[model samples]
Target: MHLNYTVGYIIPIVLDALKDTELSGDWWDIQPGVVRLCGDTVEERTKNMDKTTRRWREAQRFEILSGWRDEIYTVYAPKGSPFFYMERSAHPLFGVLAYGSHMTVYVPATPTTPLRIWVPRRAAGKATYPGMLDNTVAGGMGNGAGPWECIIKEAGEEASLEESLVRAKAKPVGFVSYFYVRHKEAGGEAGLLQPEIEYCYDMAVEAPDSGGPTLKPCDGEVAVHILMDIDEVVANLKNGKFKPNCSAVLLDFFIRHGIITAENEPDYLEIYTRLHRRLEFPTR
Candidate 1:
């Protein structure tokens, strides 16, 4: 199925779920291997899409897939055109492309000290990837927010880093793309597709003595923040201690920093190529 020019892959279970909703009624044209919103204008499409999704949410449909985030994410076409908005939880159901931003916060090595990163552990109570290590700051881009703004917002929410600090220090360092399959850790059925693009950023922070901020758990999503040197982080990555996608972002960081190279890793070329997979859906 295609949303305008953006391809959307629907699984069999998702198709069966949609058949039980208003989405299969007048709002959408649901045919085998093809689906389209049935509306003449963007406003009409958005309205009908919202109504259909809201009904499913209220009815608690797709509960087995994932819990509703209540956050809305925009589906886009080529040239950054907004096709419509859908609830965040429903995104994986339609297998639409998802956008997010991740920032790695670290203090560069000094003559006496090695480079160290601030890593956060997800709270044990969280629904997804509980107690796993995550990037210093990461979040999904929602409600039409741009990547830069999303990063800054997530920095404060996830790590209690002030916006001024992030705005002053963060540098956009390209992105990492991946095709993810959801499983128990992701709180969804096995094999649910979630192709994602995360706008990556890196921040070289000053030591706290220089008036730089120290990470603290502001939102309950984070259990705690720890400052660990490069060696420890590499060990965790090898042990699969980080969330899979977050680990991918860290691998991107390592490659960018010249840590993972031909001399060090046998599969350096393969790993580098897979980090930026050419996605099937439209990304604007």
Candidate 2:
């Protein structure tokens, strides 16, 4: 995929931060200023990067905690093992697009029924993408949690779902990946490099009238829960009403469910390939 000029510009800044670090990789001319950390083991990489992040934090004064939980996410090898740890806030500056997972719960459409998906509205005061539409339950993979673990925790925290229910119903379908470069919010400060991959899941839920399970925002992250028909969801996606990354996940859902197909979408192949772009990172 072709990146925009902004992403091209930020690549070198992230590489420069690694100068003098013990990361074992060619510093210069590695994919045009992109630094790939090659390490002997997870422990070694984690220790080295931890020191790098601390020094970078002190030297740059970058805000350390900026997410919903102000947590630290373990940077992982492509196979999903911990490589290092870094504060969520500093990820963008380093061009490290952290991995996350989310689930979309839906009532399946039958011959007589219509497909409907659960969408959550982020709280207006969210530090990022406030008031935008999001998946039913979404959270980043932290230092100690894998994708499944993270989703279960997010389900309970964001939607008050019981672990037993989520564990029983959620199925790991696939993933949607994208690279986004965000410009600075104000002034001339550097912008963020966000290359994200969402491990997407799907869960079948009882229809609203049946009251199979009630979804309420147990935490302050969400403002409300909404059940919208698949058509409406697609419309919102086209209108850019959903969070950009969330939109990619929803589009993947539609493609998998046959709601979108090659015959209908002119750019089906391109969209399909881009949604699962192969990152340089190791992913299991």
Candidate 3:
């Protein structure tokens, strides 16, 4: 199963929900309306929406962000009886769950010098996942857009990557299943890489630090980033890893597509052995 690649083309990215570090974009209503909220309580914020907030308003763009809209990269309408909407000019979505696109870096297994993948550390902010973890690049729904283009744009934002960089050595593989809620506050420094929102997309690069003359980051979304070894990432994942999309879908995709024959593929061959057992990792 050779992993089918998308045509050599790139899409514009808007920010939303993602879990990777090397991507450019923003999450939900956290964008242009990321105000200080001069008030003390949610009620105050709602009131402010009516009077002030010269930029945002309900039933419109601002309202679009109210409440959590996605989780683990999956969109979900508010469940059960919610405690009042988050205000239409409100993003009523809860800010407790995890929602966004994500990428996992890895060096290919091949003769001679196979590539290695590293998922550098994101900045120390409200969005960085539990302390720090290895994730490729993930972003939000980019105002309800698709994930393919989203991932590409995210790689540029978080990784300070240029389209030309990944284009030279990257290609998108099949996607995985990522089911989640809508109002979950992603773990990381809450902010956007570019000025606009973004969608989610996943791709494979030849190396972590792969860059070119056309790639650069205008916004200070990502800190110093780097690419590391997949063996270390897999080991870390096996030992209470932060996010396992790397092991869950990415690795499997590579194998399914016949990209490389991992030496330790058998030990992790539980899909066929335990087809009836439940899984314990994120998808898509």
Candidate 4:
């Protein structure tokens, strides 16, 4: 659905941080209260920005890397192959909402059964969005990995899934795009811009004894994996138990699976349109 919340104005500190960088204004466009990087190709612009952002982070002492400081995420233009790599921790500081992908796994309800979904709770000690409910498998796309590759890696790491099963069963089901301006209460520096496009996928697991592997938290990032009925999932969504973006992903699942349709919802069209809101950056 279209985001019901308003994006907060860009905080001054963010702009001030970008002021002196060689990659500022010249490499990025700041207008209409939004910031977007510009370059002929993803590689050229991303490389320049990565170097500039790294140097700025070091000089400014914004050392909250939490072990992700060395990890690199591929920054893309509006679409297509990645342009370059950037330290994962510095994405928000520069107001660049890097693109990532997520997968929703479920077992279709039989005539006598109810639909069930897999949900994971973020670890309490995580750096961002700690103790929040997340999708079955979610992660940022890093350099040299495509969407499918990224999902497989995340699925194995976060949920202990077999790579062969993931490749054989995962089905890409479009994406969910939103521009989120996180407020201080949401657990980040106030006015941190997080424009993102989540390339969503769906995986239908077989019933037990069909050789489907059980899901368990293999990585410390997830505390537990809970299987909840569709009704219970919707309840959690309404109660704000799921992370905001995860909520969007689940809502999309409902729409696509015929669980949420125009006959039952008053704002069905509006919700569908809102989920794919056209972003202003990267000229996509």
Q: What lDDT score belongs to each candidate, Candidate 1 first?
A: 0.85, 0.72, 0.39, 0.74
Q: Which ranking of candidates, highest TM-score first?
A: 1, 4, 2, 3
lDDT of 2 by residue, 1-284 (tens): 22122211245556555554443233223455344444466565556556665565556534432232446766554455555666666567666657799899999997887899889999988777778899999987766677889899999999998999999999999888888666443112345667777899999999868877878999998999998888889888888778877888888888899988999999989988999987765443
RMSD after CA superposition, every candidate: 2.3, 5.9, 14.9, 5.8
Please give the ranking of all candidate structures by lDDT, highest first, separated by commas.
1, 4, 2, 3
Model 1 lDDT per residue over 104-151, tens place: 999888898888899999999988889999999999999889999999
TM-score of each: 0.91, 0.79, 0.46, 0.81
The parts of candidate 2 lying over 4 Å away from their true place are 1-70, 77-81, 183-191
Model 2 scores a C-alpha lDDT of: 0.72
> Which residue pairs collide, candidate 1?
none
Candidate topping lDDT: 1
Q: lDDT score, residue 59, model 4?
A: 66
lDDT of 3 by residue, 1-284 (tens): 12121111111211222111222112112324231222334344334433332223232233334332332222122332111112221222222112245565455655765445545544555242433553566665434345556666777877666667555545555444332222223331233111111122344545323442222233455444555555565566567544333344444444554543546466445542331222232112
